[model samples]
Target chain A: MIGNAGDMNVVVCVKQIPDPANPGSLDANNNLDRSSKLIIDDSDMYGVEMALQLVHAAGSGEVSLVSMAPNGETAGLRTALAMGAEKAVLVSDDTLKGSDALGTAKVLAAAIKRIEGADLILAATESSDGYTGTTPVQVAEILGLPSVTFAKHIEVDGSTVKVQRQTEAGYDEVTCPLPALVTVTAGVVEPRYPSFKGIMAAKGKPLDQVTVADLGIDAAQVGGDGAGQKITNVTAAEARKAGEVVVDEGDAFQKIVAFLDQLKVI
Target chain B: MAKVWVLAESAGGKVSSLSLELLTKARELGDTVEAVAWGADTASIAGDLGAHGASTVHDLGDLGTSLPGVSVAAAIAAAIEAGTGPDILLVGQSYDGRDVAGRLSAKLDKPVLTNVVGLAAGEPPVASHAIFGGATIVEATFTGSAPFIYAVRPKSFAAEPSGGSATVAPLSVPETGATNAATVVDRHVEERSGPQLDEAAVVVSGGRGLGEAANYAMIEELAKLLKGAPGASRAIVDAGWVPYAYQVGQTGKTVKPTLYIAAGISGATQHMVGMKGSKNIIAINKDQEAPILQIADLGIVGDVHKVLPQLIEALKARS
Candidate 1:
């Protein structure tokens, strides 16, 4: 099957998120602050590597990176360029500054439409903040295209993609016609490191920017007001109590052995 | 109000565990939960869905044992359109559920919510997904309007009996674009005991502390007696202690069981995301300092070989 492979063009959607550990804070309205708490999520970074593999394989069509972060997400775009995306486009704007999954996809779809047509659009299954995991399907829906969620492996030929869709059990290899959207999971491929030379070259790549205004979108559609549901609150989970001691070690092993003896497995 | 739809998965006239779990959650979310079934005569499964709360069961005439998920999605969409559109479409988070939900959500312009453990509706339908392995919980609401389709996490919500008659009807498969896209040549299912992990309410997971792959027997033995599923840390899976399918972490499968037992494993944030949403967590590790102990509801500071045997014996006695 590899011998009969054809060239493929792939585009990936990347989002910058706050590190999950330090989810940081939200406002009175339960809104995540973009400027203060923004960095790229690790999963989206993997999405980049998946795209690179498709484009790098047999030198098919171009691999492009599209980010839907607030204005000044060019650093992420540059990062993608350094990692070897052929081009980068940032869909940024104040209106989209507070976009949720739907608004973000709306902006991204417009940005993707502006770019030269793509054979596939790649994305992570979910984002850390919203964690809703709805953007890919929403984008595919709005664009009137087919989509596969949580695709573990993708082999492409021009516009058609044979995707290994992962389920709770095993996986299924489903082929969908060209111009489909695929949201990937981890372990698809190890992301590449940006070399010094590649980093330098990335600085010179074109990074066209688009905002909600640029897309002729309703400003209300791009902000906190646009999110169909608002986050009511964010609080730390209740702390767990420490563990029980069945036995210590060495000498504790004997005590544990005694404990097990009581339970009667011995 | 448009009746909510639950797409019941079946093969050879029988429903999978995930379908039952989905029906359980669907009844919890909507007032009128109806099921859309396909593949052979699923009248029995339809009855089962009613026993677990289904107002209507729209059977699409058993398309086949392994119908393309996209084709099933088309049939579901057509049913939604012809009858009252489902207020929200609920599905299992399995492969077919994921495939059908992804295609249906896009085609229907509804939100796709995956790996959910719970469901509630206020304005937009909200679902809970165990993220960051299990350290954090995300309560996310669908992005848009009603009829939002979701592939809910199995075992996340408890199934209940809403016993009553369900309206069973026929739905024709729609020839959406994917009809000519790809065809399934054949399908082979991976065999494993210990209930489907995602569908298991009790999951006993092991880690490097087991010392050897054969040591997994202790964990498996306990899981079997309890009728629970067994999960492995990435390190154990990488060490070849267990198959990759059993690994539960950022790098492994995600499970939101009711009770999760972690034996002899240090918890990485990656590993925690997979099982954090478990209602109760118990960790037994030789290292009392293991990070897993931090999230454990009941932690036993000891080697798994010692603690596990005792625990297993206690369980066996009780049974």
Candidate 2:
């Protein structure tokens, strides 16, 4: 297979976010006021799975995990390493905090450029938390790579790839060469779990510590500076209240008439 | 001299609706708005762009086709690099837009705001965007060089008309060939039976209030009568009331229309972001205090199963 012996390098960019699939309430100013535990979003996991499949299929490639989460997110990167990534690179710094979608993409692209010379990169269609659905595109743009976003199906044959795009109305099929990028959509493929041995071996893997300075990057380039679009204010989402219910609980004939009269259902 | 630029996407060699809106919003921000089109139809760039208030349209000729981010950014950045780019770049907040905005910002070393709703360009570009699934509206301003990229949210700007002559120019792509990356052998668009989902001024969505599958016909009847596309809450889909494709929530699609009517909905935070952009929301639930009514412009306290049928009948009668 094409991947049999270090034929290509795969890079998966993942983010650590609070789970939104589980219902929860938000605090004032609209931040995820959750308990301080985080996990990798499912979208990123699917991305990792796709890369793993490609590497496994070609038989000669390695998968590398790259993330923008701070030291607090080390646990999540370690999990990626356990999931079969050969190594982990953590792009963390005080300067890289509070990043929105664009800022995060900038950080990932800069980090990707500095670490490994990658032939392919993948990410989730969108994060479950911010739900911007814009990161993949932004990341591609930042890296100056050709991108295929919202892909429901992806097939790589040697140097070229065939992608099935998910649209509101239907799906589209597109083809692109290697050294390209893709954002996998939900329901594309389920990511496998890290085996016990994989988990054990991951503890010995290098979780490289990189900051805004390691890549000759300035604080401004990280998140808070000129390269980012900073948020000045945050407003809570307005909630909705319940409405009145009208019922008719009489006999069949009378119930129809009453229900019609009360609900104007007639 | 402030100028706003719209990078348009094309289908079968014509511009897209979102591109039109991008140019319209850009026109709102600057004295001179430029619509840049690169693809099969370079000749029509000036005319289409001028119609949307583009004072200058650079037509990079017969450029095989613009890929998501590569070709689009190369053409746009080369212009900016050579000093023909606009003060602000407005793109539709879709996959293509994100790609272009990200690459353009990196190449130009400027700030790019994704999923931005509003823009104010002065000493710097301030853009209003949604965060935390529309729970918080974040106001952002970029302090960087010229040609800041913005992926504008949908329906934020009513695509208005601009009258001007499209002055076509035979522009050229940088050392990079006319084509960037990715080949477009075929493009498939989902067929809509009624008004387009994003364009529908009125949308009647189904929720847990829908009850079961057999009951969804009533909701469809209402949507068909109103000539609108139906939106489904995750509850209904999760409950097998409809397909997951119809679901509207944080993980699903984000849309805005003129009037949104959610029935049997409890108004979860994730669900609200998808429709909160609507100009008016009307919620009909049996529970008078159901969560869906908070953002509703008009809250109708009643059973949706009953109210919906009658409303459909009323709409049909009016028609």
Candidate 3:
């Protein structure tokens, strides 16, 4: 009872994050800084790409995006939109500043429900930043939909979604009904860069910005107040002291082998 | 006295070492330590769990091809609703563990603390997580509710057996209709040689410094010569030079081997956190200033292309 009628409506959960290379420090409240400009997470791009490809394979569907960013940030959504997504629902509220993983999932699931007729949902296994790695499955739980994580490959046959779910050992072929959610692994597909025409088209794409109140979520149930955990303190980890530094004088391998020998491991 | 429950996993009728590690940590944190497991072998592994300090084992029985995420989570939530749940639930940072934790969090409307590396006993129990690729350690504690869930990283604690026996308790999985629709149709375990990456005493990891994908063969050969395992940095794994399973870094496997040999790896903080715990580290790189060398017991400032072959030959000659 899950397959769609040929037109597969795919929803991708996209996250806009601070650049991992120049990651910002925690603010006074120990929350990650998001006041500055943000870009789409590199990890989420694979989900975006997978969503687009699935829609393409379905022949008559569209890819929609759901994101929660501060200040109604549309920059990250624009990138995904340029990649041929039809529209997006952005949840931006001042009260959602210090939202934890569960709070964020609540907001996302609320926003996703607004998109009608979505047959499948996709998200990255974990974000590049804030790798809580539970948002997609949490969203599925809230929506009462089946979920699969760590997908290296995905295909749609009729109403069933088949995923090659990645595991530490290898991978498992999992099949779920339509209207399910999947968290895609990174590098599953090659994401396309935005071209001039796509970028221009993205500007006109419908980016419906909403607030917590608009999504029928209480301000008290989000941000720091609703968070179930608090960061009591943060300190530098004990650094390992630097050890012997010897420039390889042709006997470097010998020294290494000797060290291994000393350890009785070789 | 706080009650702690660990989500245990088993394969080949043996409890996973990570689960035992969690059980060990749970014993240190709580007066009552219990375990929750699914699958047909749950009863078979109860004794092992008991030896690891679990006094009680909640068995969800066999799932019959259905993924454990939905049913296992529902069963735990049902227990909590019945006022028989633990004060804290510790789950390993694994695929099924994350799924169960996330679903249970949603079901109970409680937040979960993930990436935990340390824990200390307290009224509510505080957990420590490494942030920014383990550069800064953040100590956090639950604020809202009991049965606080923590997804702990593997190898964070040592698994020790304390002589005991656990009483198996049957827990029924609530009828989860649509959410339990996903089922495993097939499984494929890749052919692996040598010891497992995390369990291997000697681990030789390569990086982008290996120059090309073909050069990874040297890493495999050297690890084979040393009777060890092969690993890789995120750079080469992202480059598609190797599978993600070989990755050893912030987002990958956490290895604490006796001897770790990093070849051509620049030792990004992300990479360092994963292998820095090794008892002895040896870094071979052309760049004398590579960060990996700083923590290495033996720093060999040389090109891996030249140094690896020599090490391989030297190791081969000895054998």
Candidate 4:
């Protein structure tokens, strides 16, 4: 399967997050509340879409998803599954409740390995919630695979992946061999909404649920106690009090200029 | 007292402002502050790092066209294995910084406290991170091991120079194997003028409410009149109205300009986190109840297309 142009198997790492519109709260252990219903993170949709497109471009390949969440939630996976992903591998266990970036990476790396012949692994550069933005690289390290993060565009060539990696100044053309992991930035591609037929087909797709123990990772090393950092205290940030709100009476521009004059910034 | 190591980044032979900010904070938290840098121009930044509080500069020299992430991380991991690591490693949340921190974390099996906005000197070095779009602050400490890694946010501290010089030291990058295979074959820089978004004194940003991609010119024109920079909300950037470099949000650049003007932008929390630190915020939007109005110093409820032209004409008249 290596370097074959036609049959590329891609794995997309997806994250299930709480709605960003709603305010989130911390739990008793100082963790962001995950008891609420979770949906697929908006950022991951691009990766899923990119993977599906890559597979389709290869003419004969399938897209699989790997995710970690609480309560064995498949609500998010089902969304990607509906987006034409062939299958999913989910790692869910009570022990993963307070896992940090490294811990989460460990679980994800383990889940990814179970897939027999994934030529490429994909993920968003960071999750909307818990934007540590480090999991993909850590996963690459664990699997000993080359990785390219912040990919704005990706194209698979034979057994290699070429990426337009985003940088501070601009973009860099980067190339890595197959069996590599790439973290895509948002806007890399426009994600497609699941169609009626796709939604119907997703229900029958295979979703294998595994625990930390099943992955041979010690339960003790994948949870709160296993986290490398501990939350000591949490407090509300100093709030910026409300200022004057004015209806534009056709002269609001004067007020803006006046405000700038006051700040002496204009 | 703790020994601190700051990851310094340089471009065109000058160190980044964020690296200086990190070094300033590192000096305050540790007894001895050192810096680590890569690239062919690493030597040129030693004086700047030293003036910012790093007494020693560890130069990894040039790695040809190979990405610095793998080699830099491997070198640091090797340093730790050789029992020469610092008590705390402060990394600016730059692109390369994240990659090195992540790979090193995996190699050392350590955890990194990322998005750190504040730090305190302590046994384990407590780091404060802003969550919920800067609504809450969480103070955390590493549970195990020294050389606690922290990926700090930009503009969290001021960069103050002490007028000192650094002693340059050569550090070696161990063999990182296939993980280092990703190579940079070409580089492209999108030509941009005016002050940088993160460093500008005055910033004018547009959102989806700007209506079309062409409308962003108003933002640029206004910013230019104010001698500042033009920025964008993630909505516009993601929608292809502007490049990602112009984006201002949690995932984008955090800008704490003296004056931040939001035109036709209903603030999202993600976008708020990036610009909430501005000294003065003025938002103009038709939706009076837009979240951005809540924190803006002056909130003008109006259509951007109308307000922008009038504001631009008024500013032009003043000049």
Per-candidate DockQ vs. reference: 0.26, 0.35, 0.71, 0.86
TM-scores for all candidates?
Answer: 0.80, 0.79, 0.95, 0.98
Enumerate clash totals for all models, in the order shown. 14, 28, 1, 0
lDDT of 4 at B276: 92
CAPRI class assigned to model 1? acceptable
- Per residue, candidate 4 scores C-alpha lDDT tens digits across A11-114 of 99999988877888999989889998999999999999999999899888889999999778999999999999999999999999999999999999999989
Q: Which lDDT tens digits does candidate 1 get at residues A118-141?
A: 777898877656555667766776
lDDT tens digits by residue: candidate 4, B1-319 = 7889999998889899999999999877888999999888777889899899998999999988887889999988888889887878999888999999999999989999999999988888899988877888899998897879999988999999978789999999988889999989999999999888898898899999999999999999999999999999988888888999999988899999889999988998889989999998999999977999998989999989999999999999989
Binned by DockQ into CAPRI classes (incorrect, acceptable, medium, high), candidate 4 is high
Stretches off by above 4 angstroms in model 4 are A1-5
Worst 10 residues of 2 chain B by lDDT: B171-180
Give the candidate order by descending lDDT: 4, 3, 1, 2
| Candidate maximizing DockQ | 4
Q: What is the TM-score of chain A alone in each candidate?
A: 0.85, 0.82, 0.93, 0.97
Strongest candidate by TM-score = 4
Rank order (by TM-score, best first) = 4, 3, 1, 2
Pairs of residues at least 3 apart in sequence or in different chains that clash in candidate 4 = none
Better of 1 and 4 by lDDT: 4
What digit string (tens of lDDT, one per residue) describes model 3 on residues A1-266? 22357898999999998876674589999998887788999888888989999989989888999999867888999999998999999999889989999999999999989998889999998887788898889999999899989888999998899999887679889999889999987768888998899999999999999999999998988898889789999998777777888887787888877887888876
Chain B TM-score for the candidates in order: 0.77, 0.80, 0.96, 0.98
